[model samples]
Target chain A: MSMRALTGLKPIPPSEITPREVFLDRRRFLAGATAAAAGLGTAAPALAEEMAMKLPAARNAAFSTTDAPTAKKIITGYNNFYEFGMGKSDPAASASKMSVRPWTIEIGGAVEKPRTIGIEEVMRLPLEERVYRFRCVEAWSMVAPWIGVEFNKLAALVGPTSKAKYVRFTSVVQPSVMSGVRAEVIDFPYVEGLRIDEAMHPLTILAVGLYGETLPNQNGAPVRVIVPWKYGFKSAKSIVRIDFVEDQPRSTWMKLQPSEYGFYSNVNPAVDHPRWSQARERRLPDFFASTPTLPFNGYADQVASLYAGMDLKKFF
Target chain B: MRSARAADGRFAWATSDPVRALKPLVFLLCLAPALLLVHDVLYDPEALGANPAETIEHVTGDRSMQFLLGTLAITPLRRITGWGKLIRFRRMLGLFAFFYGVLHLAAYIAFDHYFDVPAILADIVKRPFVTVGFAALVLMTPLAVTSTAGWIRRLGAQNWSRLHKAVYAIAVLGVLHYWWLVKRDLTWPMIYGAILAVLLGWRVWNETLGRQRRRPARVRARAEPGPAE
Candidate 1:
């Protein structure tokens, strides 16, 4: 079979695929372009990822954001994966040491079908692209095109028992590979949780890829949860365990600062962080300007009913 | 002896009128950080990565704290080096500290709050870090305004020195502001604290020793014939 036939993929347009020679010589092109554009007599090399891979196309139009997707470099280069380190760029620099291959996620607690599923089994499930607006509690936001299966699919496969009310997600905590785990910044094996209903929502996904390519280690490789309506930290990364529990799980941030970060970390602009205002957010790449933050990060229309009568300030 | 005197004369000439000779250099050095930030924003945007505003705010805030610490160190540094000329730069350093403090506040108001006065005021009142930082800036404003020679003369040297002692409090507040703002790592704030400790320690040590020396001289004066008698 031809390459396209074997892969069951359509042929890429010539204009879309950058030639290998041009990709190889991109540094020189970038230098000239940056010099001409800046006219500052200084050459800045473009921040191009060496591991180039083609990303998949968006599969779900309903879940995608109208906002332009954040650049791949910014999305991958800037991260808050404190498992690698504290600095935003530290994850991108140090996460390469992590081993994601042969990963397994253990499903336990109130699940009827408690089993350890391998990476291959998880990937084999139906996958779709979802463009999500990720709002950080730090008052910054980004939009990403993530490709993965819905969290409900995994939850259904495991079959949560009637007693299960909350689903807890635990990230891999290998001190040997992750240097940040060595620091006592927070308890290791970073844990996060979602209400069972929230986990079952169509918007929640077990993301494995972004921008059509397998997730970079910095962006949470292997598999991670993408909780669109909540702050980015609520979506646990590099997940290793899923526990269905009767009680709400004590997430890492909530455990660290109960008053600052609450368990129900839904994106609410009316509620402000103690240190910073949450009413506005500085969108990445547009550093000078800030736009008013939307309630539920602009996902309120779909998820508003989830917290219809609850006081957000009290919960927040 | 003649050659040594000649060499001293040449040294005096080289060091003469530090206000004229070295003030401009100190001014330029103080202005360099702000200029670099402006250049990065205008021409080389990527130098600050995806969030230039945050980077600018952080850099300016850090520079302001560094200058505050630097201003505090001038006296101790002069004592160690015996470079009386160093005294000429103290006012410039203090002014630079105030300048960077203003810039830091401006960045917060402009980029973070977007000139939202009520929001800015609310943040200062609500956040402990912002409260302490705002306190430090408020303390610095008077010091910067009364830094002129005329103001010093008007206040009298004794009152002027007393009023300026608030800088020590400002330094402490600045460090506290930094420590409170950081999420986890305390390395930078700890370093700033250590430096401030040494500077304050030197001042306390000198004051104690000077008092002891003055007491003995007073005793000696009593033993001798009184000049009035």
Candidate 2:
């Protein structure tokens, strides 16, 4: 939050590119109610496909990881979208009412030319599959192949002014659909933020699909950012607003418990979450396995230099 | 109250103590949740969902708190219904609470940490939530050990009764353990706490206001030694 210049270069692609069998064999897994999904189950295939976007993109080498992807069911079924409800399965069970169609994301704040981008146009932006290690602050993690356009590609569409030092993301709160919205779980519309450099980093992407299918309603449906280095909550879901701002935005978790959740919610083993240790994470399927959590979730080579001069210990 | 209980006793099959007839049913009912968890673990793994270990911990912990509260509820319920024989189930309910609590602790130790002593000790020490949870279980140990009729007879009913009152403190600690550990949304924990408060509030009311209402009843209550507490 203090003085630090972005100096990290893109990490060299590890020899272990995204495994083919990991994604290929997983096609048999059930796809949730998504119009864009290949096996569109419901009577109205055209309507569903219209609402969802199909990705023909191959798994990109650079963003790929060697880790096996969390089964699509677990990735789709077990979600932390508080809008649906607090339980892990609540999102999958309760998100059916959410209408992802007729969605438009408003981009504004300190940008040179602010404009609204529809879900269709947004999803069409050169999609690619990137497997990332998704770690939760609650000390569980999963690996998943996400299909989406890079954040920089989307950010390039809207020219940012010098005043745009930070990026604020806001998720839509539909009280009619989302029961958690009515429950008022830590403010209805979940808010998150990113430093301008972090936002522009190549590792960052706006994910729209998982396991080669359209994003499930529970899995942020139309759009969500995937910042592999940060905690999963930092990848705000059901996003409707992206504001380029002057100051760092107060994320929902940060607002709820500032001491526990920081603006830079980087996955750091040394900085333990007040309630639980961030040192080890339970990888899904291998639920009891104690896998040591890496700094920046093993993306330190690409992102650590961004925090070069600043003391990560600072309340800043 | 004695007259009501005596009158109710006439309908033994209808009310209980013929509680022997109901005991096995209640036992099976209590064992049901644990059985389902076993079934899920052994045959249908995914039934517990993505994190079965966490689910087991939650279910066992939840049932433990529920039975602990249920054990507390018996006295008030019996008093309200004028069914003295309802006292027979208290031991079973209490022991079940202890049983499920053991299961809860076992899941945490075996599944969560795989019996890592240093890690667990560090958790109990460093985390206030874990510490409170561990303390609640520790306090329950003596109560659980001394729950038998033989032990109650050895300890004397009055002393046994006084010792078992620690359940109230255990209840508080259990609720505090729950309240402290929740990531967000105090709804479930608050509901459990509310139930605990009501159970605790009933005793406080009986001790204070009920004492004035039935001054002579105090002598009668003292004259007759209650069941194995």
Candidate 3:
């Protein structure tokens, strides 16, 4: 096959400093410069207060790097449910219309140190960019560069108790602002959850942004989770709340149909849905008829241990 | 007499008792594009370019929805135009939709997953799009099973009609299922969404007009001197 087949038809445009960037940049600037300002300016203490409340920056910062292959998959396959109005890709297009600035993640529930953190305060953590392959159950896959913190590290800031067996995620459901939610055609207030162990997986992430910039609204701006071992939906998007639960929390898919959606939706090639086969997937960047799917989407070594003793068939 | 004679002539052409009649002919003609799509998947898989299986699945899926949407438009079209003859093809078109849906799913199984049952099951649980798409397929099963005259006769018209109304829900699911599967392009989904909106809008309009037509007659009859009430 010719490399000519892959020649660019059009280049991805450069990232712009949207209202979101300016707003976040201001917040980050304030938070980082707070120490100097405490002596020189009145703005310093407020910034310091904001920074102090942020979820622990240590672990989240360590997991922020994005490598090329993983980045490609994450960018394409991890769709923005905000875009198409519902489902995954809804965010990819519809998110572009959103004013993502002035966004704050509300962290409350069973937490000893609950706090609402601004996007800028979250970004102030050291960011690592990692490239991860994203596979959709729809039989297509993409590799993407994702930027965020390891979810375990982010969750640590809240000091999750042993009582918390699950982590529930909530997306904003504003119909007046989110016109897609107004459509009676689709159910709204999309929710997803992960078991505490799954939530704290080293591969699990609380992604802040992607492609070397703040997340595009279509890509789950503000923040989203990336659970590489599970089917893409397990990751959730446009996350607002991260409640630590004593029980396995209900996710949108499982709520829609429990017979099919299991709590542990780990990526396993061993099980097939009653309606369709799943032995192979269409690898994105396929650019043609043949790109073979990898087991565990090429993250088997990293994530396989999470599912050691479980029956994948029953769990699936 | 002349108008009646002309109507008879048109009916004869529309449904002459000969071997290849109008319904079958129109069905075949309407089915050609989808048939060509299926052929490409089976015979010329390479011709599909990037992701042949997905391209085929998409073509089959798009056509299935188009057929289902077309099938749904029949009654509303007849009501609006008073061309009740259009209802003659609803069963055929509906079956064709089922046929295409089955094929669309088959492509997913055969080409995409290579018949890996466990992996497919895991995916359905993991992916919302696949789950919805799978639900749409399951919903189609009974509709296809009951499409035949034998089953329809056995079930009776009222029960059969009620069971078949699931097609409307399926159409909505089918569109959503398709929309969810798409990566970036909005053009195709926007087209289908607009078309489905109009198709569904026509149904609502027809129902409202039907209710309005029945209301005055009911009131007037009650007002008239009659034992009917």
Best by lDDT: 1
Off by over 4 Å in 3: A1-89, A184-187, A285-295, B1-56, B64-110, B113-229
Task: Tell me the tens digit of each residue's lDDT in model 2 across A1-316.
Answer: 3223354444445434432322432332223433337555553433433334345679998778998888987887889999888999998886766777667899999887899997877866888999999999888899999998889888889999999999999998889978888888778689999999999999999988988877878889779999999999999988899999999899998889888889998999887777776777888855474788999999999999999987776632
Query: Model 3, residue A206: what's the lDDT?
Result: 79
Off by over 4 Å in 1: A1-57, B1-22, B209-229
Per-candidate clash tally: 2, 1, 45
TM-score for all models, in order of appearance: 0.84, 0.85, 0.56
Q: Considering the true interface contacts (CA pairs under 8 Å between chains A and B), give the fraction that model 3 also has.
A: 0.07
With a 3 Å backbone cut-off (N, CA, C), the pairs that clash in candidate 2 are: A35-A48
Q: Which prediction has the highest DockQ against the true structure? A: 1
lDDT of 1 at B141: 98
- Please give, for residues A1-316, the per-residue lDDT of candidate 3 as tens digits: 4555588445444343243445545776666566565665555434432332222222233333242353333354345464245444445434544445566777766677777866665665555665566766655666656778777776767888768888888876657657667763335677888888878887777787666655555567668888876777777777767788887777777876677567777666666544444555666534232345556666777767777887778878
Q: Write the per-residue lDDT of candidate 1 for residues A15-54, one digit (tens) a residue.
A: 5666432453465456556667888442221222344344
Model 1: DockQ score: 0.47
Instruction: Going through the candidates in order, state the TM-score of chain A alone for each one.
Output: 0.83, 0.83, 0.73
lDDT of each: 0.85, 0.84, 0.67
